[model samples]
Target: MDGLPTRESSPGVVVLPGNRAELVAIVRALAASGVPFVARGAGTGLSGGALADSDSVLITLTRLTRILSIDPIRRRAVLEPGVVNARLSEAVLPYGLAYVPDPSSQTACTIGGNVAENAGGPHCLKYGVTTNHVVALEVILPEGEIVRLGSHAGEPW
Candidate 1:
């Protein structure tokens, strides 16, 4: 999500994909048709980047909130973009782990939005920002290609 804020604006289309495959297909079709679109995760962005304009398609990712995997030993979790920040920490609490970047909006903001904003809060001074903790990503490109990048191992950032 990266664009101007639109309050009270009506979008031409609003899509909520239930799964990754459906999301990919929608993006592919939109790209091929040359339709302008914006993707959003949880719609809790303070930057107003998630708001959609009248002519563009708004792809809301709220339905994609699944924490796919959690490796407590590695301190890494694979989650859909819409999973709330605090939820991740809560999920890992039983494992004696916590997601450290405690943004003020953590209770409402999603991990994807935090990644987009490189979000940090009071813990940043001691723990660093989101990038420092994120090891890898499975990204869907603007043209609808799914590509996995980076090593899910040791790293400074």
Candidate 2:
């Protein structure tokens, strides 16, 4: 919340709520606040995707980390943006389950960031980028509409 960088060339910071309902509230406030904001994960983004402007608010999603559920029968996982990529595999290993999309930053990068960038790793040559594995995304549109994008059909959003 505080002690966050807010330089003109850097990004600003704003505290966010911890749960989905609170996230919705923040999104609504952001839409109406007339302030520019960018969502961030582990700050592992190499592209300009996670970068922010001086007037922008950096909505770090690190606090949203969680592995809600993993369905081995369905070979699917319901996860929060803050979940670490490799952690998913480790968490679901006993179930004979594994996440297909694994990036180089799998140990530290949040799954949410991987989704945002469609990240790829060495294994990507065989498995493909993050976009190839994602099913559905519960997203907040620009107008603060929390909508479900994509489907459980393993399509890109």
Candidate 3:
């Protein structure tokens, strides 16, 4: 892992937000303080997408692991960024539902990372990648403003 081509400099600070409010606050404070920051998930991505250089702060989403809501009838689920990719499927298995993005690192990768990388795996040949399964996204802008992209109704905004 350390020898991966995508590996970069180490981060100076690391923070894990327990919830949405805390995540927002941290982003706000970091922005106001003029410190660079990068959002990171399971850190299992082969592309080094989660790497943060020394000048940046690493905001790990591990603590935000929660399946916020699920609508079996709609086949939609709202989850925190830290939720593991495989866990989502496990959670909805009883409802005969599953998230379709099956990244190779599914067991350890987080939904946020899957979204960031638009990850794909063996099943992608039939199911498509993360972007195909993602119906919406609730994201915090660099300035600390939060906004929703796309909608639960499966419409992109």
Q: After superposition, how far is residue 89 of candidate 1 from its true place, in Å?
A: 0.3
Cα-based RMSD of candidate 2: 3.8
Candidate 3: lDDT of 50?
75
> How many clashing pairs per prediction, in order?
0, 0, 0
- Which has the greatest TM-score? 3
Cα-based lDDT for every prediction: 0.85, 0.78, 0.86
Distance from true location, Cα of 118 in model 2, Å: 0.3
Global CA lDDT computed for model 3: 0.86
Clashing pairs in 2: none
lDDT sort, best first: 3, 1, 2
**Compared with the true structure, what per-residue lDDT tens digits does model 2 show for residues 58-100?**
7778788789988888878899998888988799899987776
Candidate 3, superposed: residue stretches over 4 Å from native: 1-6
The 10-residue segment of model 1 with minimum total lDDT is 1-10
lDDT (C-alpha) at residue 127 in model 2: 85
lDDT of 3 by residue, 24-120 (tens): 9999999999999989888888777678888899999988998989989888899999999999989999998878788777888899988998988
lDDT at residue 36 of model 2 (Cα atoms):
83
After TM-score superposition, what is the CA distance of residue 123 in candidate 2 from its true location, in Å?
1.0
Give the local distance difference test score of model 2. 0.78
